[model samples]
Target: MATADTSETVAHNPPCTRRGSKDLPPDLRIVLLGSSVSENSGVGNFILGRAAFDSEAPPDVVERVGGRLKDRHVTIINSPQLLQTNISDHQITQTVRECVYLSDPGPHVIVLLLKHDQCSTEYQECVEKVLLSFSERVLQHAIVITTQEPTGTNDILQKIIQKCANRHFSLQRSSSPDDLLQMFDNIVQMNDRHHLDCEGLQNFSMTQQPTEIFSEGVKLNLVVCGSDGTLKSAISEQILQQTDRRSDMELHGRQISLVELPALTRLSEEEMMCQTLRCVSRCHPGVHVFLLIIPDAPLTVEDKAEVEKIHRIFSLSINKHILILIMQNSEHQTAELNKQTQSVIESFGGRHLFFGTKTQVSTLMENIEQMLEENGEGFFSTETFWEAHMKKLEEMLKKFHSLQTDIQSQGNLPKGQ
Candidate 1:
């Protein structure tokens, strides 16, 4: 429930003082988390008002550099880039330990430096893992400093900022050191001028343990289909160990049966009908959720047609069980989606999730659970339901054909006869 300071002015004075204070410490310690060695070092230099960190140094270990910023003794703990795929557990542990040891008592604020191009799901997971490794309440004392201005459409970045209690600063927008320091001051005051103590650090060891992926006696039937075959297969692979069309597994204490259907738009009408029936039969009892995977790009004419085709085949009733999964990567960084995509999302009542890592499978499950609770615990689709749905479609098609025939007959007879 952290409220944001909506004022545009940069000259607002903080409620607390950090310099020469009687009760507060004289040193202002900060930790920097970034995607690369150069990024972390550069931010550290910017804060210390000098070239304090070696950007060219080996990126394996963490380093602490101290200097004086006006009347305040400032310390910067430059951590090696932890937001990468290949970073080992040992490296993460060693870096966290070094950061804690160097900062001594603890850091006043943790600054997360993100570039516009680095806001992918992988990076999101990495950031979450690193922060949780430090302390659960670490974000309470954290400040997200993006290198560029953040837009409202970047859901992942917005979520991180929200977790930090709306405490955010843009380095590109405000380049002045004083402005940055003022943000730090705001964090200190908000946290009651207290740093993350040993008790908080003790919470660090918990994230090191394996994540339990069970929910106890819950079973989920998921049907994944979309316009992109590659994305559909990839997401299906993440859920099921084998690459078969249908696979079953136990996750988050729920037995999950997943069925991946081919892109309907790519198939002939007969093939599409056959595949649709197969999809319904495989998940025989009923489908709990339908995941439609799409590439994270501006909606194209083909994309819109693909979505329309899905509705036509599954019938409009499929809308409630559908969740649009947008696969995001570094290549497609534009957050401003086109009108067509917006309209499509609105059609589904904005049921969507930005997908990136296997870690998010649990999140997807939770969302599916919530959707089930809201829409009732019944299955979304079954064999009999699909058969009746096809019958309705056939009846609608016959009516349309009869109306066309009647219109043509009337036009022929009334031609000035």
Candidate 2:
């Protein structure tokens, strides 16, 4: 329901008075990304100004909130370089390292600020690579926060989201401190839950034994792309749960990162490609499948063109794989509706795949397995890591298996039997 509904309200304003100070960790590392043109770029200047002029400004909000300041803990760094030229891989990597990596205190969260202009393809690709490198070290630790002041809905912002798989937030009409604080809290909570959930999946245990050899080279990296957070979150959570339940299955672990591609009120093909390339470069190399999460809604000519362009870009590489997942809402399924949706996606070179309305556990498992097979990875039959897990499970459940067999054979014999 949250659409870019207004056309005359996008205005860039100067920073307003902030409310209660942000209660950050005694000393926290904050990283902000933006261009020189953005109004909020003056954050550094504002901080410096407050430090120098406001001697009576109550003890720094961070200190008063029972936070600790370990040495080399509080650091704020911004990329000094621009993405205007030489978007080569080497240049992009080096710039990011210099700006983002060198900060003594690493960032807990990353905030991306954008206005309404389209980005060049070179810049987009460079940014994508930088993000990928960042993820290698801090996968679940990354959070993309998009901020937009009341101005016309930005096509560039929407493109960025589509490409980067980051989260989005808006600061439409007001610049109130309470709103800022609330947004900050949401970022912290979301990041905390995401990291914890990933850790859980990465550290799950099993109760079985195995004797066969499995493929060690195959890595199934699945990237699910969509605009709706509800559908995205639901699909990702279900995939994780299903993978955890199947001990015998060669589950190629899932890494669910959301890309909120910016969709401006106006359309610009050049800007869209640039942003998409940037985000794609950050993805895992083993990401054999790209799931385009499309909601069943009427598509505009511009929307259709955007899809066509993205498809062409993705298809450039024979190694890159892509799929279309058209998620129909809670409405009754009809033949005509299905036909219309399928045609729309197929026009863009994507196959229309459906995951049942409830997206049941069975459906999740089957869909993943099918994807793995199409991408040339064999069934859940061959994973050495999983074999080891099976071994462990077999050991733990060995006694129970014998007991159950005896009871079944003797028609419910007593435990002593």
Candidate 3:
């Protein structure tokens, strides 16, 4: 039997190319979610090699436009900032829904924009909320884009950001538009393999069990925070047993994933606040434990005030996550700092430990374990929790400004009115 008409078989099979398969989408549809409209708009223009989408004055609902990027037709949807605005989640979901139909099929990719310069508790929460709103199936198509202009030296930061979303890119990182096309090509390939967006995609994050928090394994996220000009780094190094070879300040014990943060009193307390919160949300996603480091020296008024501010910022589930770690200059110096810091410890529910040296973190770690056991990692509402944090920050900032105004006005009051 001569092989059944090879030409006919080949013609019928056609190797499953786009032309041989079902009708192809009119163009590539991508929805730009999250904040950073200006930067994202710029990125959209960059991808298309032209100013296709206007970044000015983000309007409510959704805006969809098509452009030509390289040889392929591309459709870009720029969505408004959801969490920061009055738009309800329903409205946001509906806007995303509109995006699906605007391209005549659905988005093959969702570009989530996260700005490096503006990362904060609110921003991270907004990002998590928006991304988490989507179903897990959509996440496979999701890509996080950071606005940080990457340099050759930023490989480590790039990797960290990439881990947060599983797939990440920087417009500034790629040398040219070709690099971007390659990324889009990969997305298209993977999307084609999955055959996603045959129907309008839904958005939602299922609630995780509180007990599942600690059961997630050895990914311990310990935040070492203190006032500006304190010995947070030094103390963290000691507690984490960071050897000379491990001088990066990250502790990689069999059971601990410790990260030492700079003083919360740094130039941008707002920035630091967001950085801390983002660290928890992205790196630690399950359970977060805070090591509130206080120096052994006298508790300066500034240190006390900074401690108060940290407390206010981390008010959500703080009672369960925060631990007071007092760093003393010497064994004898611990006595003085202990007495001086009684108020701080009391403020933190009297769960305090004084370490004359670095290896003294065992008891502190035990205390944290106990706290986790008791708390079981309660429900965390990303949007509500962080919006509340921003409100508290604003209130504290307003109060500080008011107090400064009072003091200045008092100085001007002739003869102490």
Off by over 4 Å in 2: 1-30, 33-105, 108-214, 227-230, 241-275, 300-305, 316-320, 335-340, 348-350, 377-417
lDDT score at residue 337, model 3, on the 0-100 scale: 44
How do the residues 239-270 of candidate 1 rate in per-residue lDDT, one tens digit apiece?
54322222234322335556566566656576
RMSD of 3: 16.8
Ranking by TM-score: 1, 3, 2
TM-score for each prediction? 0.44, 0.39, 0.39
Model 2, span 2-23: residue lDDT tens: 1122111222222333232343
lDDT of each: 0.67, 0.42, 0.55
Candidate 1, after superposition: displacement of residue 288 in Å? 55
lDDT at 5 for candidate 2? Answer: 25
The C-alpha local distance difference test score for the whole of candidate 1 amounts to: 0.67
Q: What is the C-alpha lDDT profile of model 3 across 255-351, one tens digit per residue?
A: 4444444345543454555545544553335435677877766788778877877676667456566777777665455344456688787777767
The residue pairs that clash in candidate 1, if any, are 213-252, 214-252, 214-253, 215-252, 215-253, 216-253
**Model 3 / residue 69 / CA error / Å:** 17
Q: CA RMSD for every model?
A: 22.3, 23.5, 16.8
In the predicted model 3, the residue pairs found to clash are 121-274, 133-203, 133-204
